[model samples]
Target: MINNHMLKRKLDWDYRQRCIYMTTVTVEKRRPLLGQLTGGLGNPTVELSDVGIMVAQCWQEIPTHVPGVSLLEWQVMPDHFHGIIFVQAPQEKPLGAIVGAFKAHSTSLYRAGARQEAHLWSPGYQDTILLHRGQLANMRAYIQDNPRRLAVKRAHPELFRIIRNISACGHIFAAIGNHFLLDAPVKRQVQISRSVPPDALAAAEADLLAAALHGAVLVSPCISPGEKQIARAALQAALPLIVILENGFPPLYKPPKSYFDACAAGRLLMLAPWPHHTDRRSLTREQCLALNRFATQIAQEDHTP
Candidate 1:
């Protein structure tokens, strides 16, 4: 199951509304009792253990037990389960209650069969409530590829690891992705102001992309719209990049799919000097300026003699 380092729910969101949610329920202590990934990276498949199969069966019965819950897609991973479900409007229970019932029922079944663990799942689940149809489609693709992705990570552990206490640009950070990106001799900071016009922003991005193509590591705080657009473009072009963040990495931290793939390819380095936080954060003006300054420092420190 995904870690609940992120909040259980959106801070002020109404859980009663009709929403599409992707939830992750992890096994207690992350035991691989559910299943194993087979067929290798070439043709990955989840070979469900007996318990895994039973748990999956229980997942299928959630709708029958909980009204206003529709199961869209689900994958029972070796250590945790990922499910995409739609909670309809005018519901009898919120998303948490529905998930709680499923967990309770599954544990009962597991215990009835004389399982060792008192509980099958961890205390709570992590949820991602999709905002739009585009996000929903991307989540579907993510769930479908979960097995293959896990297989690939198993094949290459070093690239996907979270390494703490990394020293770079006279600062310490908890970092994920290729730490080696910091060593590039031609690192250039991309500092675009929010006030830049569309045309100038386009030009600035093009210049950065050209430099990236010529073996320069592009660094950015990625706070401003222009910077964000350029950063996205840089990743799309598969160039090396270093991103500065205000928040640090949490335990069992994994980057999103785009960043994950970039990390696997050793083309990205994300650095955060501050400690990790679970609460949703809004960037203060002071923090934004400080992070932008950090990008400049990171780039300057990497310049070769």
Candidate 2:
């Protein structure tokens, strides 16, 4: 089994910029790599030359329905596949939607022929949006060198270049066309407000505030002068404040600090359910829920005594 390290960088979803992204997906174990990779030295058991070709075509077709898109370097590894998918923001769908389409269509084909209900691939995939020039080059190099790293010395890299062109940055390269993909709609900046009774609002606010303080990046809900004061205090203490307001109402006031990162140590909290700590830190969802339940049980017992 391969030992993987804990992923470090957290991607801030930018809804306004279209960016090039690299996605790594893996196949189910006990399945031969032959079907995934083909035309390489040291033949794989389940030669997927046909499947890889089909997927490559699918990657190209993605841009037709989705605007501002292109395919860069891609390879089908024995147990995994790495591909650079480009997306121009403000297009037809989210990046996840694109991945889902690939996964769904490919799985259907694999299932119908394989006649096995076993998982076709792993559930989680890794995606990184190229935020800067250095990162973009790194992603392209990674995809291009995958053949050599996988010990396929006989493979030719140029065969995989379905698209390539010169970049205006004075460097010619293969990247999903230049366009900033908008951040897809996600649950961020939650609001709790005056629509509810002030008392309930306070309680809900406290719950959300507590959740954020305990590691949620929730902004404050109210924009009142008092709320802004509270936000200022929380930032001073290095707590991330979730800016909130009653539904459809502008913030009555803005907080003193304009920069959120300056308030915290660049620590962004993960979004999770109640009793669910964000997975941003090391703890898993199960571990978080279990520990909380256990603590609650002990507290209940002490109260009875």
Report, for every candidate in turn, its global Cα lDDT versus the true structure: 0.86, 0.46
lDDT (tens digit, per residue) of candidate 2 on 201-267:
5665566556556654433333334454445555566655333212111111111223213312332
Query: Which residue segments of model 2 deviate by more than 4 Å?
Result: 1-11, 34-48, 152-305
- Model 1: colliding residue pairs: 1-80
TM-scores of all candidate predictions against the true structure:
0.93, 0.42
| lDDT for position 234 in model 1 | 92
- How many residue pairs clash in model 1? 1
Model 1 stretches astray by more than 4 angstroms: 1-7, 115-117, 302-305
